[model samples]
Target: MEQNDHLGQARDVTEFPFGADFQSILSLIGDGVVSTDHTGRIILFNRAAEDIFGYTSDEVLGGSIDALVPTRFHDRHREDVDRFCSSNAPLRRFMGEGREVLGRRKNGEELSIEATLSRQMIGGQHIVTVVIRDVSARKTAERHRQLVASEVAHRLRNTMTVVNSIVTLSARRAASVIEFKEAVLGRFEAISRTNDALVSGSSTDVSFRLLLESELAPYRDDDSKITLTGPDIALDGQGAVALALVLHELATNAAKYGALSTSAGRLNVDWKVPVDAPPLLDVTWQERNGPLVAPPTRRGFGSELIARSLGVHGGTAISSYAASGVGCSIRLPLTGAPPLPQ
Candidate 1:
């Protein structure tokens, strides 16, 4: 009887110091902890486990651990447990390993979790402990990042397509070394201006007003040759670049052989957004007081550039000669325009 009392006193002393300590450790853990016996019956549910699965220790302790596993995985999980128990070998611990698994909550909702499994021996009986962390938020963030990357790549490819067309058309028109160099430089300048506008807005869409002013800067002087008349409109990057190249070609042609070549010649530019029908931008460029004008016997670089650029966005340009002067009208589908700035 005396020896029995001594053993009981020893047990009480050991348990007293560890009761609060073990509880504190479990409470401090960030991941859910679930312990089950070799038979797969739950034996311990830590504070984090309760929060994660919406189950109290008392409610889960004597229940099957399979309750916390997704229904689809329960059969395979059972077989794994049986295999481990029969082999008398501990399954590999998964701490710090990024393994994805499905975990079930009290309401039967399945959550994606990263988990670590470990084995412990207590009183000659083997127990398995699982530590689970919810990874749903991380997975969602990764998906969003991937979507943004894909959109950026697609926009870049579209931008390069416009750049390629501009370079090809400009290179074909150069008759002399000096002319080729000037043409290439001119095209590069136009692309730089468009890129600057896009960067300023931090978006693919650019302001139509900005694009026109930038393209006409080189030709604008004391003479009031370039004019704008329209409510402000926005153009997506691809549309803006195409339009810039079209205007450059027109201005270049006029300077070399058309209206802008003479002292009295001037170009009138105007545009409007109609409320009725699908959105349209009607731009008219009329040359006055220039030398006698006639359509080219063969299509030139300027003509091809204008046609191809407009065609990129399903648009067309019509050039006509009236008794007054040569008039060029461009009609573009405004589908490429950006939403009005708030």
Candidate 2:
């Protein structure tokens, strides 16, 4: 009786519809597994499929596979099913291999998915199995990477253009090879320092005080020699870059012929924002206790650079020659600064 009972149990296991362990294996899979019969009715909906589609196996089994497809893709899904039924393609093929496909959950939320389809003839009936993995996170990450790449490219082009202008302008004004080399190297160093500060902080704006200190740090002997008085002001990227060039030119001139060249000299920078309509920043630069100053015979690259530094931003710079030293006044529109003329 025991042998007969064992034989009957084995026969029951063999006659099971899903084979001895097919359903058990499907339950352990991480990716969703779904199979449909020739009539497009879902036949096998595994545990993973239930989780992915937000449906229970009992709710999806024996229903049309269209239940899991988004409305926009229903017609295409049916065409693909018809092709599989007719064996128009290979027996097994991957879907959405290089691109994301759409899937609709039970709650009508659309999601990105990657799927693989396998066609088989089981007991003279056409069966199609699909293995699906959600790829919404991966798609989002890819788009983010593309945007960063495009932004980097734009910034690099702008930087290279500025460098080219510096090289060409420096060469035009240089008196000799040595002068050209010195001018180009000094300007490059100033730009590099500004870039360093810009990247050190998470914000795109740079402090006006920071830009001044970077250019004047080498010449400053003590607090008495160099004075900077102004409220904290932030400059946008283009503003920072333009102001850096202007500051470098002024510091270079002072070091060669003006206040910074003398030990007893003093340099003062003061700026104020008055209650004027549409806010303006008024900055004054004064020098004292240096050799008697006189205007240049003709305006040079330094003067031209200072005048145009705020380029198309509606700012102005003016210089005055005093018996004591050199003085400059600059006015910059703090609000409603316009874009550069294209």
Candidate 3:
């Protein structure tokens, strides 16, 4: 067994023998602990080092440290090691300094790592020890967090744009300040309900059924008066918010003058998206058992908002006040719907 001493000289180290007990203690450590002499030849490769780099202690003994580092970093690594050995700095860090720490594996793959280096005199010889930790999982988690944050920011910006459009158009159509305030507040409430549904879901956006149910939740009771029937359909950020406002207006109209206004009244909301290159949402808002209906003498701002809320690219809305009931059939080009699950 080799010995080390206070003077750091091989011959003088007889006072401190390197034994199996010392090696076993190092092997128990979680981080890879690698030690090298003045020549950068690895003298001790602990079990954790073998697990990290896929190299056995016998295979890496007396080997240069470069074998464990990426090719691009070999030169800098050697230079830094030389500096550390010559300087009085007791310890050094070589990861997370606006630079990545990489380690090469026996299979030629490079892995992310963090390491701390320290130098000491043992029996008159310079010895360098490094404590290395694998950081790949941490790096992956950080990237995922960044992606989620960016997605949330993007959705918030789109929501603000939708709100701005609603306020601007409502203000232009209002005859009085009170009308403008009520219109804007109602639309904002719809958006708030939609966002609440989104918070309950695991994804960044909510499903179409969830958004619809949220808008009509106030009236739903043991009667199952408010029902949603459609395939599970995911809506993108903007689509969810826009559709929520439209549904809220429909429910408001129903509660005030349509089926929801009477105990015996019934409302049926059914939607379908036919298979096409770009699918279209066919939504039917039918009211039954309500007061005799007649076409409105003048179109209201609420009706106008429902037509304009979905945007102007391609959409159709037709409302009829029949003798039996009041209803609307809307065909909207569904854009930004999520892909079907695998």
RMSD of each: 7.8, 8.3, 5.9
| Model 1 steric clash pairs | none
Runs of candidate 3 exceeding 4 Å displacement:
1-22, 35-43, 51-93, 103-111, 117-129, 174-182, 221-224, 279-282, 292-300, 312-342
Question: How well is each residue in 1-342 modelled by candidate 1, as lDDT tens digits?
Answer: 764464344334323555778867888898887777776777667888898898997777667888898888888888876665564456756633455677899999887788777775554567677888888788879887897687568767876876677667767877887987788777768777887887678655787778878876766774576566766788876677778877777777778777778777777888777678588777888877787887677887778878988897888999887645678888888865744676
lDDT of 2 by residue, 1-342 (tens): 764464344334323666748878888999998887777777788899888889998787667899999998898889988887796343888885676688999999988888989988665567788999988889889898887677557656766777888888889999999999999999889888887877785555677788899999999878899999987677666667777887898889989999999999999999777765567767788988887798899989888777766664577888889989888887777643332222
Candidate with the greatest TM-score versus the true structure: 3
- The lDDT of model 2 is 0.80
Clashes counted in candidate 3 amount to 8
List, residue by residue over 130-244, the lDDT tens digit for candidate 3.
9999888898899989988997798798788778878888888899999789878978999988888776777766777777777777777645565566676777666777688
By lDDT, the better pick of 2 and 3 is 2
Instruction: Give candidate 2 regions above 4 Å deviation.
Output: 1-16, 36-78, 88-90, 102-112, 121-126, 198-210, 220-239, 258-297, 306-309, 312-342
Best by lDDT: 2
Better of 2 and 3 by TM-score: 3
Task: Provide the overall lDDT of each model, using Cα atoms, as 2-decimal numbers.
Answer: 0.75, 0.80, 0.78
- Candidate structures ordered by lDDT, highest first: 2, 3, 1
